[model samples]
Structure formats: C-alpha cells, structure tokens
Target: MAKIKKGDLVQVITGAKQDRGGDRGKQGTVLEVLKDSDRVVVEGVNFVTKHTRVGQSARGSREGGIETVEAPIHISNVALVDPETKKPTRVGHRVEQVEKDGVTKTVRVRYAKKSGKDL
Candidate 1:
C-alpha cells in the first residue's frame, strides 16, 4: 500500500518558511501521484505559470495564453497530516482480518501512526 494516496491531505515539510513566500507548513490535498518520477502534485501548492502560443479556437475565440497550475514536488518533501492533531505524521500499515462470504481474509491497511487513526 502507498503511504500517500490521492485525496490525502499533506503538508510541506521541507522548504522555505511560509513567511518567506514558500509552501512549507502549508497543507493541501494530493491531486496526483507521479509514481514513475517519485513525485506528487499537491493542490494549491507549487504554483507555476505556463505560457502557450497564442491561437484562435474553432469558434474564433481567444485560445492560448498564460496559465498558472500546480507543479509536482518530490514525495519526500511532504508528510501526511494527522487527523487528530492536524499536524504532519508518518504512516504505518497493519494487517486486518475481515469475514467475506464466510471466509476470513487478511488485508493490509494504512494508518496514521501518530493518532492510531485508520487512513
């Protein structure tokens, strides 16, 4: 199981302080996970501007222009937020048993170690 998954709330643990115009300490939902690159894009974090060639749409309306979007950040730089404390915390996994169709099955589940809350 992945420690951090999409829709998980995460905080920037490494970066310039927020007072310095950085995202450190800021929390946001994980928008995407780039597994191949070991990176994750957090919503409202790491904003970057994109410039596209000016063009016309099929309806003759204005097309491309400058746009701002979130950029992917290294996964290590973020930590999962603890629901109880509203702070960053490490994730842990445990095996749980459940009865399905009269059969007991073991499943691996992720949880927040800080508050022992299931994730």
Candidate 2:
C-alpha cells in the first residue's frame, strides 16, 4: 500500500479542468479512500450535480432541483502536497529507525523530493 492516507493534503493532477488556465489545481484534505476501486474522495474536488425530488403534501413544493456536490476522483489523479513548499510533489518511501522499548525499529516513512523533507 502507498503512503497516501486520509487527512493528507493533495492536489488534483489529471482531471479535465484541473491545472487549467486561471484555474490551478485545487488542494484539499483526502476525505476518504476507496481502495477497492482505486479512487479517493477529496474534500472539495470533482463536484457533481445531485437531483432530489420534492415530496407530495409539502407546502410550496416546487419541482425538485439539482444540487451540486463534490464527487470522488481516482487516486492516480492526485498528487501529494509537500508540507514545506506547499506544492504538489511526488511521494517516496524510506526506512527510518525509531526507538521502542529501548530497541530501534525500522519503519517506512514517506518523504517529498521537491522540498527534500520528510512528510
């Protein structure tokens, strides 16, 4: 599994409108992980229209209208944002040692190459 996890900041990279003129890619927290489908739902990306029907016997119930809501995008479509530079950067993993019970344990850690910093 990759290091990309929920709450990590990410930028949309391969959508139709992403990184377009006057509309740079948006940055937001990863809301969910759809690992089975290889997709993720960002907090505020890939908006879609949702239509709801008005129930009968409701006062002033006009025809149902469509509401726009954020939708899920594929994980491959986003890049992790570097903490230091505040820009999107590729993710890489490295083994680091951590002290536990007076013993050093090696753990996989994610790092950002663009900023040369551990994330």
Candidate 3:
C-alpha cells in the first residue's frame, strides 16, 4: 500500500498544473487515496465541475445542481509535508514498540524524512 493516507497533508511538487505558476508548493489534506490506481484526491486541488440533472430524493423532495469537486491526481505529484518543518518531505516507515493489557507488540509507523518525526 502507498504511504500517503487520508488526512495526510501533502504539497504538490510536480505535474503540469503544479509546475510554473500552478498549485506548486501548495499544501492540502489528502482526501482519498486510490491505491490501485496510484492516485489521490486532495482537498482544494484538481477541481472539476459536474452538472447534475434534477432528481427526487428518497422523500421525493428534489435535488439537482452544478458542483465543483476535487479530482484525483497522480500520487507521484505530491509529497508528504513535514509537521515540524512545515516543508515537503518523503515518508519512511519504522517499527515501534507498544504495550497494552500487559502485552507488548511492534507496529509500523510513518515518519517524515526531513523532520525525522512521526508523521
């Protein structure tokens, strides 16, 4: 699975729109990660407009309108942001010990390569 996950803050580092004067260096939370496709939906990024036809609700109320929503972007275009440094960084995994109910176990955790802190 990809290291990026929902709620992770990421910055656009490369891609057409992320180049030159686009959303480059802009950071936002990861909304969804499409692991199978190697893509992700980030908040306030890659917006697309969709027009919906008028329809009835379960209660027959009604619903229809145009809306703008985030579109999926290639995962390679973004990099995780370091919490402490507030800069873009790569992700790395490490094993840590945890104890619960008098039992100790190891778990994998993500950390920022730049800040060297748990992400």
Candidate 4:
C-alpha cells in the first residue's frame, strides 16, 4: 500500500487541473486508494463528467445520470499535507521499537519530512 492513507489531506503537485489554476495548490481529503495502480482519488479533485442514462441503482441513488465525480490521480501527483506546517510534505518511514507485555517489537511509522510529525 502507498504511504498515503484514506482520509489524508493532500495537495496536488502536478496535473492538468493544477495547470488550469483550479486545484494546483488546493488540498483535499483522500477518498480512496488504488493500491494496484498506485493511484488515489481525492475529494473534490480531478472531477470528470459521467453521462449515464436515467436509472436507479440498488443503492437507491440514481445510477444513470450526468454526474461529476472525483477521478483517480497518480500518487506522484500529490503530497500529504503536514499538520504542523499546514503545507504539502513528503512521507518518510521510520522504524521504532515499542515495549509489549514481554518483549519489544519494531514497527514502521510514517511521518511528514517537513515537520517530522507522525501520520
């Protein structure tokens, strides 16, 4: 899985939307992650128009109709937002040891490079 997790706030670094001055420096929450393809869908980012015939789905929501939904953006195109600085930052992995009932174990933790805060 990618370092970025669902619900993480991320800002687009490079994309057509960024070039257009709409989502360039804007930050949004990650709705989903496509691990196999290393892609992520951010809330209110990379919107695409879908034209579907009028119909309802089992979910009760209309399945067929023109709707705009967030599209997947490559993982490299976005960076996680640092909570401390409130700016986009690269993710870094650090190993830490934790004491358990009998022994200590090593675990990997992700943090922002800029602020060095745990994610």
Candidate 5:
C-alpha cells in the first residue's frame, strides 16, 4: 500500500485544467480514498456540476438546482505536501523508535525530504 493516506496534504501535478491556471499549484488535504478505483477525492479540487430534482424534504429549497461539487481525481495525479516546507513532495517511509513506559518500539513515520524534517 502507498504511504499516502486520507488527510495527507497534496498538490496536483498534471491535468489540462490543472496545468492551465488558478489553483493549479494550490495545496489541499485528502478527504477520502477510493483505493478500489485508484482515485482520491481532494478537498477543493476537480469541481463538477450536479443536477438535483426537487424532493419532499427540500420542497422550498431555492438552491436545489445544479450544484457544483468536487470530483475525485486520480491519486497518482497528486503529490503529497511536506509539512515542514509547506511544499509538495514525494512520500517515503522510515522506521523510528518511540519510548513508552520505558520501552522502545519502532513505528513507521513520514518525513519531508525537502526540509529533512519528520512529519
């Protein structure tokens, strides 16, 4: 499994709209992981319009028309952002020791390659 996970910060790397302009280099956190489909839904990215019909619950809702919602983008298209540098970076894993109750245990952790800091 990839070290990347939900809540990890990421920036888009490729795509027509992504390459063209605004928010292309913007960073956001991963909201959900669609591992079966090899896709991830990033917060505030790949927005699409959705049309909804009037329902009993939303009878008087004026904002029931076409609504734009963020769509899922492929996980491969995004690079994880390093917390230290606050810039996009690739993810790698390493084992680190932590002490608890006078005992040490190795735990997998993420580190920022750019800043050489543990994330």
Candidate 6:
C-alpha cells in the first residue's frame, strides 16, 4: 500500500521556507503519484512555467502560451497531514480483519501516527 495516495492532503517537509518564496510548509492535495519515478504532483506546489507555441485549433481558437503548472516533487519531500492537529505526520500501517457476507478478510490500512487517525 502507498503511504501517499491521490487526494491525500500533504505538506512540503523540505526545501526553502515559505518566507523565502519557497513551497516548504505549504499544504495541498496530492494530485497524482508517479510510483515508478517516486514522485508526486501536489496541487498548488512545485509550479513550473511552460512556454507553448501559440496556435489555433480547428475551431479557430487561440491556444498555448506561458502557463504555470504544478510539477512533480520527490515523494520523500512531502508528509501526510494529520487530520486532527492539521500538521504533518508520519504514516503507519496496521492490518485488521473485517467480516462481510459471512467472510472475513484482512486489510492493511494506513493511519496517521500523530493523531492515530485513519488516512
């Protein structure tokens, strides 16, 4: 199971502080997870400017320009936010058994160690 998943709230744990115009301490939703590359794209974080060629679509609408978009950041640089305290916290997993339809199954679930709340 992944510690960080899409839609999870996370805070930048590394890099320059926000006072220095960096993203550190900034919290945002996890937009995407690049497992193979060990990177994650967080909303409103790690923004990069893209200069695209100006062109027109089939409908004759102008397209493409200098746009700032979120870029992927190393997964280690982010920490999941604890729902209770609203602070960054380490994740821990625990296995639990649940019965449904007369069947019991074991499932690994992630929770925040700080608040002991399920993630």
List TM-score per model, in order: 0.87, 0.74, 0.83, 0.81, 0.77, 0.88
All candidates: CA RMSD (Å): 3.7, 5.4, 3.6, 3.9, 4.3, 3.5
For lDDT, candidate 1 versus 3, the one ahead is: 1
Pairs that clash in candidate 2: none
lDDT of 6 by residue, 27-70 (tens): 99999999999999999999999998878778897777799999
Task: Please provide, for model 2 over 11-115, each residue's C-alpha lDDT reduced to its tens digit, 9 standing for 90 to 100.
Answer: 876645544532137889999998888888888787788998876555765667798877878888788998888878888988899998999998988897775
What is the overall TM-score of model 2 with all chains considered together? 0.74
Better of 4 and 6 by TM-score: 6
Each model's lDDT comes to: 0.91, 0.79, 0.85, 0.84, 0.78, 0.92
Model 3 steric clash total: 0
Find the 10 residues in a row with the least total lDDT in model 6: 110-119
**CA error at residue 66 for candidate 1, angstroms:** 0.7
**Taking the tens digit of each residue's C-alpha lDDT, what string does model 4 give over 58-117?**
888675768898989888888899988888888899999988998999989888887454
Deviating ranges (above 4 Å) for candidate 4 = 16-21, 59-63, 100-103, 115-119
Quick one: ranking by lDDT, best first?
6, 1, 3, 4, 2, 5
Candidate 4 yields a Cα-based lDDT of 0.84
Cα misplacement distance, residue 23 of candidate 4 (Å): 1.8
Candidate 1 per-residue lDDT, tens place, 15-82, comes to: 99889999998999999999999999999999999997877778886768799999999999999998
Screening candidate 4 with a backbone cut-off below 3 angstroms (N, C-alpha, C), the clashing residue pairs are none
Report the lDDT tens digits of candidate 5 across residue range 46-109: 8888998766565564545899888889878888887777777766778899999999999988
Output the TM-score of candidate 5: 0.77
Model 6 earns a TM-score of 0.88
- Which has the better TM-score: candidate 3, or candidate 6? 6
Comparing 4 and 6 on lDDT, the stronger one: 6
Candidate 4 at residue 84, lDDT? 84
Measured with C-alpha atoms, the lDDT of residue 11 in candidate 3 is: 89
The lDDT, on a scale of 0 to 1, for candidate 5 is 0.78
Best by lDDT: 6
